[model samples]
Target: MRALLTTGTPPTWTVTEIAPPAVAPDQVLVEVTTAGLNRADLLMREGAYVPSSADWNVGPDRVGFEMAGRVRAVGDRVTGIAPGQYVMAQTGGACAELVAVDHRLLLPVPDPQDLVAAAGLPSALLTEYDALTGAARFRPGDRVLITGGAGGVGHIGVQLARALGARTVIATTRSQDKAGLLRELGATRVIDTASEDIATALGPDAFDVCLDHLGGPVLAGLLGAAAPRARIVQIGRLAGTHAHLDLETLAARRIQLIGTTFRGRDTDELHALNARVREALPGLLRTHDVRPVVDSVLDLSEAERAGQLLDRPGLTGKVILRIVA
Candidate 1:
């Protein structure tokens, strides 16, 4: 099996042979076809991770988070999964030819023909799904706001909010060139952060809920934009974590600023959350209403190029690395 290794602290792609993962009775062995590149992958390359993840050394077996593949085999305890089913999943490591993951996390691809795009869906899907549908307590007909709308999770967040029946969906991006695409995707309004101030452009108390990924200065803007009692789910800190917020406004409006991540969750908690996503996904996917934005597809041999693509400023959508294909 060939897998990509991370040269610690300023990582570079280095592929080498590695043993396939051992399968547990409750897991499935997948023949990885494509894997998605995430910001987390870049952070890992820089030797950054949760302190507990020290054992997750920079190596071939520790580089990927999400992948799409065909089921090569299922463990004895895994029910309803059979060989040859096209699926996608987020596992501890997935940049290799084969990966073993819990059967419950496997998502059956709605369109097997689009498996390459499916490789990028799991992480963003789970992140925004949980943030909007769970943490933000999204309601149909509510006015929604999605910050950083051109990125992988942000673009999909825009579509999902619309799919869930939001009366208005506002998306933000640093690039004006992407505003048209964001509107095409589902945004009722697209804010070009490059030229407009998010707070002033959006006006006050207009949005009922917000799924915010860029949590620096944007956080302050989202606070003013949210309606009374609005829920703002902070899911990412791409724009730096520090922010200067107005405590008076938050208290007066009864706005609930919530934070979320799967980082500290246990297996049972993740499985439960994923189950909810799994239930709603098939219907949404069938409609072709919400899908991953794939920026580029490169062979696994071009992992370094994929890394460069991932870092391109204002890059929209996931960079996929084809594994078996």
Candidate 2:
């Protein structure tokens, strides 16, 4: 099997031959068709985000969080899914020809014909869904705010909020060119962070819920503007991890601040979370309401190029690595 392997600090990755993973009774073996490139992959490569599971350290295939593939084999206990079925899953060691994923975690590709785009859906969708519904406890008719709205998770977050019946959805982006795209996706208002400040643009006490991806100083300012008793779910820290919170403001407004990640969860918890997403995803996809954005698709062997594209500033949507076909 050929996989993208990472080497050294500020790591560089390349396609190399590696042993295929073995299947456990609760797992299904998949012939990977495509894998999604995430910021976590880039961070992991650069030795910033370490894998939370030991399986990721088992071999040269150091990092793969999400993939779309065809089920090639199923363990004895695995049911409902069999060989030749198209599916997507969240699992480590997915940047390879074959990967073994827990049967419970496998998701039916909403659009079976376009597995390439489907590959990019798992991480972004699962992460955002959990943040909005699980952590933030978002309700229909709530006013929502999504930071870094042009990025992978951010774009999808916009659409999901709207599909969930959010009364108002506001998103922030550094590029004005993306304002139209963000609005088309579901955002009622798009803020160009380059010129206007987010807190001022949205106005204080404007949003009922905020799905924050870009943390740091910006988050602190945004917190001050959240509606009373509003919920803010912190999904990613692309801007910077550290943020100073105003305890007084939070207490005065009764705002809830939550931090969430899939990496920290156990397998059972992940499976449960994915199950919730799986239930909601098909409906949204069927209606063409929430679509996963794919910036580009590169061949699996061009792993280094994919990494480079992801690293480039102002890149929007998910970068996919085509493993087969």
Candidate 3:
């Protein structure tokens, strides 16, 4: 079997042959069709990102976080999935031709499989799902704000915010070129932070719920723009790790600043979270109003090209790695 590896001090992606993963009792063996690249993979390459316990392959292996494929086999204890079923999941070592993922992590791919598109959905879906529904405690008719609206997760966040019934869905992006796409994805307002000020563009007390991935100065702006008692869920620190915020506004508004990450979460916690997504999948998928925005599709050997896209400020949506059959 061919698997991707990350070797050297500052890791680099490599494709090599490795023993196929043995399916665990509660797992399913999937023949990967396509995989998605998240910005976190960039951190992993630089020895910055740590693997979640749920990730199957750690160390230097080409560690892809999510994929969409067809089920080749199922473990003894696995139920509700069968061979030939198309599925997608957020899992470790997804850069490989095959991966044995816990059945709980697998979500059925819509029929007439558009594996390329499905490839990009899981990571964004899971991250934003938990961030909005769990950390931010989003409710229907709440005015929602998603920073980095053109991003892999943010675009999905935009659609989810609107699909779930937000009164207003405002998305912020540095790429003005993506403003129209963000609006198409359901953002009521798209603020280009490259030229516009987030706080000034949105005004005071504008957002009832904020799902922020860019910390640093972007986060500081969110503090000023947030409504009283608003929940600001911090999901990533892409902009920077540090921020000088206004304690006065924070206190005055009685805002709840929440932080979330998937690193080091135990199997039980992951199972529960996956279940949360499954429970809401019906409503979220039934409308068919939400979908991942795919920017490009590359082969597994094109890992470097995929990784480099993360550095481009104009990059919009997910980069998928298609493993040609």
Candidate 4:
């Protein structure tokens, strides 16, 4: 088996031979076709976001969060899935030729033929769904704003909000070039943070909900821009953690500030989130109104290059790694 391993250093990834993962009774052994590169992978490699288990070797810490593949074998207890079934799953060992994933976390792949593009869908889409529906409780006709709209999760967040019937979708991106792309992804207005201030693009108290992928000063600005009784979901801190908030303003407007992260959830919680996402998968993909935005596809052996590309500023979407035959 070949996998992209992290060498416990910043901005580094290496492709090397490794043993295939052994399947548990509730797991399915998959022949991975593609893997999605995520920001978490970069952080974990840099030793910034360590999982609960601290003893695991960094080398085998295979770096990927999502994958699309064909099931090669299913454990005895695994039901509803069989060998040769194509699927997408949220799994840790995805930057490899083979991975064993819990059947509960797997979703059947859509009719589309490109498994590589499909690989980037699960994590980003599910995170956006959870942020919009689960955390923010967004309703139809709501005016929504999303920070980092050109990035992987932000791009999907913008589209999902529109699909869920948001009357107006506003997005913020540092790249002016991506403004048009964001509109194509369902944003009614795209704000180029490099040239325009979000507060200026959108008047004060204009949005019913704001999804912040970049915390710190940007997040504080988002909080200040919320409409009365607005709901703000904080999901990522790409800028930096620690942001000052105006408690008086938040209280006066009856605002709701909620913070969530999907990666650290317990098994049962993750199972529930996965199930909800699976139920919504058909409609999400079938409409073709909103799908994962794939920026580029690289061979499995080019994982380092993929990581570097993801790290570069002004990326408009996900970078996928093709892993299989």
Candidate 5:
């Protein structure tokens, strides 16, 4: 089997022959068809985000976060799934020809859809869903603001918020070109954070929910733009994690500031999120609405290129790795 090996260095990815992963009694063996690259993948390569397990390979680690594939074998205890079943899963070490995944994290691929596009959905969509519904508790007619609005999670977040009946969806992008694209994707208003001030564009106490993908000054500004009793869900820190917050302002307006990350979810929690996404998948995919935003697809051998591309500025969506059989 061939896999992308990250040697704990930038501008380098080695495709090496590695043994296939053995399926544990509680895991299923998947023949990966495509794998999705995420911002976390880049951080992990730079020795920033380490996996929970020490034994897990770090440098020269097999890298990949989300994948769309077919079940080649199922564990003894795994039920309701079998060989030849097409599925998408969230797992580490997915940049390989094979992956041993917990059955709970596997979701049936939607019908009449491209598997390549499906590859980009698991991590971004699940994170957005969790941030909006699970953490933020957004309701219909709510005015929601999403920072980093044109990035992978932000674009999807915009669509999901709209689909869930958010009355006014406001998205912020540092790139000027993406503002129009964000509006086309269901955002009622798009603010270019590079020049325009979010606080001024949206008057004080304007938004019911604020989804912050970019932290630092941008997040601070968002806090000032929140409506009374609003929810501020911080899902990413692309611009730097450290940010100043006015506790008095937050308390005075009854605002909730939540900082969240999905990398540490246990199998049970991952399964629960998967189930909720599964229920919502049919409607979202059937309408060809809220599709995964894929910026580019590279061959598996080009994993390094994908990583570099993700680091580039002005990226509007996900970068997927097309794994050849």
Candidate 6:
């Protein structure tokens, strides 16, 4: 078995042979077909992101966070799911050819034969579902705003906001090249932050709910733009962690600002979150109304090139790592 490793202080990933993972009674073994490269994978390389569990601290003490594949073996306690079933899961060490995953984290692949697309769905689906519906507590007819709207999780956030019946869905991006794609995915408006003023573009008291992944100045602008009693959920800080909040505006609006991260969650909590996201995914996929926007697909061995691609600006979707069988 070969797993990707990030070795050194600055970090560089390379495939290295390793012993296969052993399954526990509550776990299943998956023969990985494809793995989605999340921003977290890029952050982990720089010693910036940490996995939820130490079990992932393998070679150079890092691992892949999400994957889609076929079940190769099942634990005695696992039922209803069988070997050969195509599945996607949120688990550590997913960059490897095989991974031992808890059954509760499993979601059936929407298209068993299309592993490349399935590979890009898990992380975005789980993260945004929890952020929008669970943390943000989205409601129909509400005006929703999403920062980094063309990103891996942001694009999904756009679709979910519309599917749930938002009156208006506003997204922020660095450029307008992705505006049409975002609109097709359900975004009612796309704000090019590089050229447009977000607060001016959307106006005062416009959004009922806001999901922000870019912090810093972007977050400050959102704080001032939020409607009264709006719910603002922070899922990422890609723009920089520190931000000066508009305290006066926040107080005037009675806004609820929340910060969410899987890093602080326990395994059981994540398993439950994954289960909930899994339940809602099939309906979206079946209708062909929501699907992952794949930016590029690379062979498993091209880990370095994949990382470089993710670092580029104006990326529109997920980068998938396909393991050739």
Best by TM-score: 3
lDDT-best of 2 and 3: 3
Kindly give the stretch of ten consecutive residues in candidate 3 with the minimal lDDT sum. Answer: 53-62
Model 3 whole-model lDDT (C-alpha atoms) = 0.86
- Write candidate 6's Cα lDDT for 242-294 as tens digits: 99987989899899999898775777787778778777877777764678899
Note the residue pairs that clash in candidate 5: 6-60
Tell me which residue pairs clash in candidate 1.
Answer: none
- RMSD in angstroms between candidate 5 and the native structure over all alpha carbons: 2.3
Position 49, candidate 4: lDDT: 76
Measured against the true structure, the TM-scores of the candidates, in listed sequence, are 0.95, 0.96, 0.97, 0.94, 0.94, 0.96
Instruction: State in Å the error of residue 14, model 3.
Output: 0.9
* Cα displacement (Å) at residue 159, model 4: 0.9
Q: Report model 4's TM-score to 2 decimal places.
A: 0.94
Model 5: per-residue Cα lDDT over 155-177, one tens digit each: 99999888889999999987888
Q: Cα deviation of 154 in candidate 6 (Å)?
A: 0.5
Residue pairs in candidate 2 whose N, alpha carbon or C atoms collide under 3 angstroms: none
Over 4 Å off, model 3: 55-60
| lDDT tens per residue, model 4, 99-135 | 8887888888774388977898888887889889899
Which sections of candidate 5 miss by over 4 Å? 8-11, 53-60, 111-113
Residue-level lDDT for 34 in candidate 5 = 88
Worst 10 residues of 5 by lDDT: 51-60
lDDT of each: 0.84, 0.85, 0.86, 0.83, 0.83, 0.85
What's the alpha carbon RMSD for model 2? 1.6
All models, RMSD in angstroms: 2.2, 1.6, 1.4, 2.3, 2.3, 1.6
